[model samples]
Target: MNDMRIVERDVDTNEVKIAARDVQVFYGDNHAIKDVSVDIDDKTVTAFIGPSGCGKSTFLRCINRMNDTIDVCRVKGDIRIDSEDIYDPKVDPVQLRAKVGMVFQKPNPFPKSIYDNVAYGPRIHGLARSKADLDDIVEKSLRRGAIWDEVKDRLHAPGTGLSGGQQQRLCIARAVATEPEVLLMDEPCSALDPIATAQVEELIDELRKNYSVVIVTHSMQQAARVSQKTAFFHLGHLVEYGETGTIFTNPVDPRTESYITGRIG
Candidate 1:
C-alpha cells in the first residue's frame, strides 16, 4: 500500500458540489441504477469505476440530469447541487446543464470552425458581452483545455477536421467555456491514443481546481493517477466509495477489491 500513488488525507468534503441520496434510475423495466448516495465535493476529482453496464455512467449523468433527455429514463430520489434540489420543477434542465458540463466517450465537436465550436456555449448561455469579450473567453477556455497552442493558428478551421485527440480537447474547451461548476466526463479517454489520454488526464486533474470533476473510466490505473476520490460500482450499486489510494489498496468491499485486482470486472 505504501507504493500507492497516494495514501493520505488532504481533501475537505463539507462543501458538496453535487449530492445524490437514495437515487435510482429506471429505463423502463430495466433498473439501471439502484439506491445510492454520495456527496461530490467542490474542487475535487472523483472517479467512477466498474465493469461495463454496471451503472457508473448512469449515475454520473444523474448528477447533471443528462438522463432527462431519454424519454424512457426515469430518476427517483433526491439530487442536489449547492444544497439546492436539482430535480425541482423550478430548475430548468438547460440552465442546469450549463452549470454542469459534460464530455463524452467520443469527441463530438460541433461541425463548425474551431472558434465557433468553442464559442457555442458562451454564445447560447450569454456569458460573453462583446466580440472582444467572447474572444477572450475562447482563448481562456482553450488555454484551460490545454489546446490553445495547437489550435491557435487554426481558429477558423472546421472542428471536425482536427485529429481525434485534438477534437476531444476542443470538445473539452467547449465544455469549460460556459464556466460550469461541475464537470462530468464519461469515458473521455476511451477514444484517444495513450498520449492523448495522458494529456486529457492531466487536464482533468487541473480542472479540479476550478470545477468539481467527476469521471467514469475503465482503467484502474487512470483512476489512481488522476482522482483524489474513487467510487466503485457493481451490478448497479455503489460497492465502495472512498479515497483513491485506500480504495485501490484496501477496499472495504470485496467486489471493489476484485475489480481492482483483476479478478472480475
Candidate 2:
C-alpha cells in the first residue's frame, strides 16, 4: 500500500498536540470504552482499529464531544489539547468542534452548493469578513482536500450531486475550512471505491503537514497504509498501541497479534 510510515516526533519539536488520560465512555448503563490513554503527536496521523463495537468509534467521538449528541452517552477522563482540558465545564462544545473538526463515515453535506458547503464553517465561525475572504477560504480548503481541480468548474452545483467520493471530499473541505488544529475521521473511505479511497488516503497524508489527524477504521491494511501510529481495541479496552509498522509487524499483545493475523477480529 502506501509507504508513508509514521516516525516518532522529536522531543524538541515544539508542536506537542492532543493527549488523552484514562478516557472512558458509557452509553446509559453500559460502559463502552474502558480506561484508555494515548498521545496524538502534532502533524501526524493516528489510526484506531478494532472489531465492531469495540469502542474505537466511541473513543474518537469523545475527542470532540460528538457523544453529546447521544442523550445517553457520557464521556469521562481527561482529554487535553495543547495541555488545556477540553472537558472543562466552561469549554464550549461548538467552539471546541471548530478547533477540532470531524468528518463522519457518511458524507453529511449541507443542502447547498459545493461552494457554500466549503464556505459554511468559515461563515458560521466569522472567520471571513467579506465575500472575497470567504471565497479564498473555500478555495484553500478545497485544494487542501485535493478536490479543488475536479470541482472548481462547478462550485455552485449542489453538494449532493457529486459522486460519493466527491461528496466526502466536499465534507473534508467543509471541516477544514475552519482551520482546525485536529481532524477526526470515522471510517472516511468505507463508502468509496479503491481509486477514490486511494485519493482520500493521499489527502489524509498531506493533511498531517498542518493538523493532527485521528481515524477509526476496520481495515487493518488501511490503518497500516495511512497512519503513523495504530491503536487496537478489544471489548471496550485499548489492547495495544504503538508505531504502525511495529504494531503490524511485531505487536506486543497476543490480542493484537491474533487480530492482525486474521485469527480473530
Candidate 3:
C-alpha cells in the first residue's frame, strides 16, 4: 500500500461544502482509516466507492460524528462544513447531525406513523411553530423524498408497514424534514430491487440540486450513474478522486484503474 500512487484531482467547480483534512479513524488501536483528505462540493453528488471494509462508511460517519456513539471509535483530524469545524468541542453532535442527515444501508424507519416519523426531527428541533407548520414540513419533505403521493393518504399509518423501497424513501423524508444541508447515504440501494434502486437514484439526482449528497456505494455502476464526483478508496487510503467520468474512464492511479477494470476490488 505504501508503494501505491495516489491521485487526487479537484474537478468540481461548485462551492466546497465540506472539507476533510488528514482524517484518521481508529477502533481500539485498529487503524480503520488513514490520512484521507477531500473537498466535497455543495449541491453535488459525491460517491465513495471501494471494496468492503475500505473505510468509506467509517469516513462517512465521521462527517456527522456518528462514530462518537461507539465506545472504542476515535477520529482525528479536521472536518469542516461550511467553514465550521464539526469536531470542535463546542459543537453539539445532536445539532450537527441535524445539519448532516444520514440514511443507512437498510430502510430502518422508526416504529411510528409515517407523519410522526417525518415530524420527529422538526418537533425535537423546534423547527415548526404549530401543527400546521409541522404538517407543511412533513408534506414538503415527503415530496422531496418522492414518496408523498404514495403515503399522503396513509399519513397516519405505520411507517414500517410500507414496502422496502417506500420505507427507504420515508426514511429519506424523515432525514430531510429538518432541512439538512448534507445528505449521507450508506449503500442506500443495496436492499432494493432494480426499479426501486432506479427511483432512489433519480431522487438522489433531484436531491443534489439542494443538498451536498455523499454516498458510500460498492456498486461502481451506481456511483457512475448518480455522482458528479467520485473518490476511490483502497486499504484505508483514498487512491483517487476526480470527476466521476474521469475516475471511471481515465483514472490517474493504477490502483483505481485496476479496481475500475475489475482487476482489483
All candidates' TM-scores? 0.97, 0.95, 0.95
List, residue by residue over 1-265, the lDDT tens digit for candidate 1: 2335467856756487788999999999999899999988899999999999999999999988999999999999999999899999999999999999999999999899999999999999899989999999999999999999999998999999999999999999999999999999999999999999999999997898899999999988888888889999999998999899899888899888888889997
Clashing pairs in 2: none
Candidate 2 lDDT over 1-265, as tens digits, reads 3342344422224365889999989999999998999888888899999999999999999999989899999889999999999999999999999999999899988899999999989988999988998989999999998999999999999999999999998899999999999999999999999998999999998998888999999888899888888899999999998788888887899999899888987
lDDT of 1 at 128: 93
Q: Is candidate 2 or candidate 3 better by lDDT?
A: 3
Instruction: Give the number of the best model, judged by TM-score.
Output: 1
Per-residue lDDT value at 177 in model 2: 95
Per-residue lDDT value at 16 in model 3: 94
- What CA root-mean-square deviation does each model show from the true structure? 1.4, 2.2, 4.5
TM-score rank, highest first? 1, 3, 2
lDDT tens per residue, model 3, 72-150: 9999999999999999999999999999999999999999999999999999999999989989999999999999999
Candidate 1 clash pair list: none
lDDT of 2 at 204: 97
